[model samples]
Target chain A: MDLLSDLFLAKAAFIGIVFAITLGIAAYSTYFERKIAAFMQDRIGPDRAGPFGILQPLADAVKMFMKEDFIPANSNKWLFIAGPCLSMLTALMTSAVVPFGDTVTIGGVTFDLQGIDVNIGILWVFGIVSLGVYGILIGGWASNNKYSLLGAIRAASQNISYELAMGLAIIAILLFTGSLSTKAIVEGQQNGHWNIFYQPLGFIIFLICAFAECNRTPFDLPECETELIGGYHTEYSSMKLGFYLFAEYINMFISGAVMATLYFGGYDYPGIDFVTAQFGNNIAVFVGMGALIGKALLFVFVFMWVRWTLPRFRYDQLMGLGWAGLIPLSMYNVVVTAFGILIGKPFTAGIVGVVLLILGLLIHDQLFVKKKIA
Target chain B: MVISNIWYFLSGLTLLSALMVVLAKNPIHSVLYLVFTFFCISGHYVLLNAQFLMAVNIIVYAGAIMVLFLFVIMMFDLKKNQPESKSSLTKLAGSVVAGTLLVLLIALLRKNNLPAPSEVNFKSQTGMVETLGKILYTEYLLPFELISILFFVAMVGAVMLGKREAGERNF
Candidate 1:
């Protein structure tokens, strides 16, 4: 009983720490996104609030809190309230399985830094992420507006279509790891044996799907303000609107963490073993934690960078890309990976992935670009 | 004792949500209630040491299917074009069919004698993915492949239904 209680307390403390970190990263993500966008476009970003807009997110929060908590008169009141709450809930729930560090030995007892490292961690992520569409759907439908409903429909269909490719992409990774646990998957990638080297094709597909799932720019069709005028949250106000926006940042952060774990190596930086042997597990743990967080933040930067670089996809183009391009390519990736694994030549998939990508770009340039120019 | 208490609470929630799914007047509300029922059933699966099943159930049913249900239901302005009220004869026929189902369920329950929790035993690994995978690949390979083929056919059939005819009129 004493040991169980000790474990419980340790788990609770770790969860609280992780919770704070997730929110802190998400809050700063908003600031970083604006700053990056401004930098990309050669304009000054928000610099009024506390030194290069360091306090901008806090100011935004205060403003959101102080604003009127308004619901549309014709809206379904209960569902209107539930939508953003559900969005925020699902966004935060995924952090439970994300392994922040390998493991920490405290007081001679080992504890995982993650909230829960269940054997089915990846499945849990996929399941919860799939449920995220419901929040947008409910919000859009409850608003009782044409634009809002259209936004919701777009979100729903987009998520469903992309999820198939996303799941297929992960199958290649699974072939290598043969385990569903996030910790196990990350552990397998240690010592510079990152899955990215072996499963390059799968990584590309997963990255695209992750972008779609997060609804960042390019795939931000659900909230295309110019088109849908605030999209699913058009009828929402104050903190409700804040919830929707904040949820996106949170989703972005989680996606970054997930990508870092799956492709880049969670906490397995180069010389991780050397550090552990020299500095001990406790000190090494912090180094690894920093590495993972750095990788995740880097991903967030790339997400924002791409947002500034690319234009949003047309609805039809988005559908066509998911169904016609990514799906078929991911299926090819799976077949190539299966053979690669069977033949004991792990780099076979990587070589094929590079060649396929180049061929695709040439085809696109030759066929599509020439047609447009002519 | 604690497990039993949790079981009771989850089962109660499941039944209540299942009831709400049928009783809710609003179609969107009904779908939400059905989603809640799925959540409760997933909770039951977790309690039974079937984490894999619980995750898949939520992903497939509550996550994907229910969202599609909501998407379709949202398009209709149900209040403005209230479902043309059913006649008494139609209502009577619905009851007759539903009543027979209820009666059959009760009769089936009465005849079955399930082993008590203490009497039956199961390995903790029984429901885990690794063991389940081994059993599936070794013993249930043919049945599993056949089921997947059935699903593929059904998927093709759905596409057929959805494909627009060239001469079809558009609103």
Candidate 2:
């Protein structure tokens, strides 16, 4: 009973820490995005609030809270309220399965630095991310606005289309790791055995799909500001709109963490084992945690960089890429990976898969594009 | 004891949401209720330790299917077009058909003497992803492949139905 209670307490603490960090990172991501965007354009970003605009998120939060909470008269009241709440809920839920660090042992008690070490951690993240679509769908539809409805439909279709490619890409990695548990996947990446080394093509596909899944730029057709005039959240005001926006940042952060955990060496660094042997478990755990966060932050930075660099994709192009390009390429990667696993040459298979993917693209352009032009 | 309580709660919620799915007047509301029903059912799956099934249920049903339902519902301006009231005779016939089906289901269930209830083991690994994968690949491979073929055929059928020639209108 004592051990069980201790475990419960440890889990609760981990949950609290993860939740708080997720919110904090999400809040600061908005500020970071602006700074990154500004830097990309060669301009100084927010410098008003606190040092280097460090307090911008707080100011933004206060403003959001103070703004009038408006609901359009024609909207479905219950669903209108449920939308952002559901969005925030699902966005935060993915953190539960994400292992932040290696296990820490203190005074004979060991605890995982995650909310819950569920066996099907990756699937849980996928499931929760899939459900995130509902928040947008419900919000857009319930608003009773044409723009919102269109955005909602686009979001639903976009998510469904991209998820197939994403799942296939993940399957390639799963073939290498042979486990769905996030911690197990991270552990497998220890000693420089990261999945990216084995599944480079899969990683590229996964990264692109991750962008689409998060509704980030180039694929953010669902909420293209100029086209939809604020899109699904047009009818939302105050903290409700804040929730929708905040949810996006949280989704970005979680996906960054997931990308780090899956393809990158999550929390795994050179001499990590040596450090654990030398300095004790707690120090090693802290270093691992720092490395994991650093990787996720780098991914987050790349997400913003790409957002600023690329323009939103045309809707047809988005759908075509998802279905025609990524899906087939990911499928090819999966087949190549399967063959590799069978032949005891996984790395060779991955390299060949990448080459094949490029060749397939060139062949497709020649066969299809040449015909269309003629 | 705690597990049973959770089971009862989830079952109750599932039944309630299923009822609401039918009772809701608005099509959008009905779809939302249906999603709630899927969520409750997924909760039941979780309680039973079928975590993989629970995630799949939520992803496929509550996430994907319900969104499609909502998309279609939102496409039509259902707010202005109220449902027509059914005639008493039609209602009577519907009730009779439904009642007969319910009675037949109950009778069939009563006729079969189910095996005695087994002890509920909380630590069962039957539903784990690894175990399920092994069983599926070894024992259920044929059926699984057949199901994929079925889905492929359905996809082709849907595309055929959706496609229209230039300047063609079926209606």
Candidate 3:
């Protein structure tokens, strides 16, 4: 009874903390995005709100809430309401399985920073994130508009196509780590060598897929303003629109954390062992948590950087990249990784895999581009 | 006690949703209900301590398959063109076939003489990913490889079927 109560209390606290951090960071990401974009383009951004627009997200929230909530007359009312709700729900759900930090020993009891330490943590994230596509699909279908329908269809096809490559890429990392649990994977990387060193090709493929999954540029064709206006959420107004937009930022934050956890070694920093030896366990845990958050934030910044740096892909180009480029490349990565493990030279195998990937890309470019030119 | 209660609730919800999937007037509503049914079934898998199965079920069935179903339904615009009801003779034949299958299933169950329910070993790691992987590679290796071959054949068949004819305009 006592243990159960303690578990409940710890879980509740962790849930509250994670929920707050996810929402808070997601909200502020908007401000950071604008600021980053402005800086990249040589302009000051959102300086009107409190002190360099620190309160811009809050102001935006207030504005969203105050705006009139409109539903198109021909739209399916219930599904319209359910669309953004489902998006927000699935976006938030992915955070539950992600380990924010290693266990912290508070007094006599040790508590995990993750909300729930499900054994199949990575699979759980994938499953929940896959469901996030429904939010766009249903929202667009409910809107009773041709543009919205097109956007939703495009989003669905793009997500499903990229997910195949993403899953294949993850298989290579899984072979190296030999475990599906996020905690186990993170712990395996505690010896100063992150998975990125072993699975560089997989990381690149996974990063591209993550961008597509989050519906960010250059894969943000679903909502390309020049074409589809507002895409799936074209008919949404007020907080409904806010929910769809917020869900994207939240997805970005979760994917960033996932990438950090998978490739960059979650919460594992250089001299972490030294810090643990000098300070206590609790302090070390906090330091690790900070490191993880910093890694995640860097990934988020990269996400924004890419968003600003690249233009959107045309629809056919996006599909071709996913199916022809990534799928085959990821498959080759898995095969090379497996062969390497068999030969007992995993590092050499990874390097060979990367070399083969580059060679293949050049060959593909020469073959396909030359044909098109001719 | 808590586990049993949760199981009962999940099973009940699953049955209700399954029924709704068939009974719903709108095709979209039916797809959504099917998704709900999948979720409830995943909950049952979790209750059985098959966490990997639960995740796969959700990812494959609820996430991918249902999304495809929804996409197809959206494309058809069924609301604008509701099909006529089935003929009475066809409905009668379907019911008869379904009834016969149900009776045969019940008869087979009775003949099996199943043992009384055993207490679940919640702590057992039988359904863990590692255990499943070992079984798949060792005992079930041939069957697993065969399934992959089957999937490959199916995929090739689909691509063949879907290919555009020469000189045909896509539109």
Indicate the residue-level lDDT of B145 in model 1. 98
Provide i-RMS per model in Å.
Answer: 2.6, 2.8, 2.4
Best by DockQ: 3
- Residue B61 of model 2: what lDDT? 89
Model 3, B46-148: lDDT tens per residue? 8878999999999999889999999999998676788688999999999999999999999999999998756674457888888999999999999999999
The docking quality of candidate 1, as DockQ, is: 0.62
Alpha-carbon runs more than 4 Å astray in model 3: A1-4, A360-374, B86-113, B117-123
Q: What's the TM-score of every candidate structure?
A: 0.94, 0.94, 0.95
**Over the stretch B41-129, how does candidate 2's per-residue lDDT look in tens digits?**
88888877888898889888877788778878889989577889899999999999999999999998899977765777545888888
Docking class of 3: medium
lDDT of 2 by residue, A26-112 (tens): 999999999999999999999999999999999999999999999999888999999999999999999888888988887788998
Candidate 2 residue runs with Cα over 4 Å from true position: A1-4, A363-374, B96-113, B120-123, B163-171
All candidates: TM-score of chain A: 0.95, 0.96, 0.96
* Least accurate 10 contiguous residues by lDDT in model 3 chain A: A365-374
Residue clash pairs of candidate 2: none
Tell how far residue A169 is off in model 1, in angstroms.
Answer: 0.5
- Ranking of all candidate structures by their DockQ, best first: 3, 1, 2
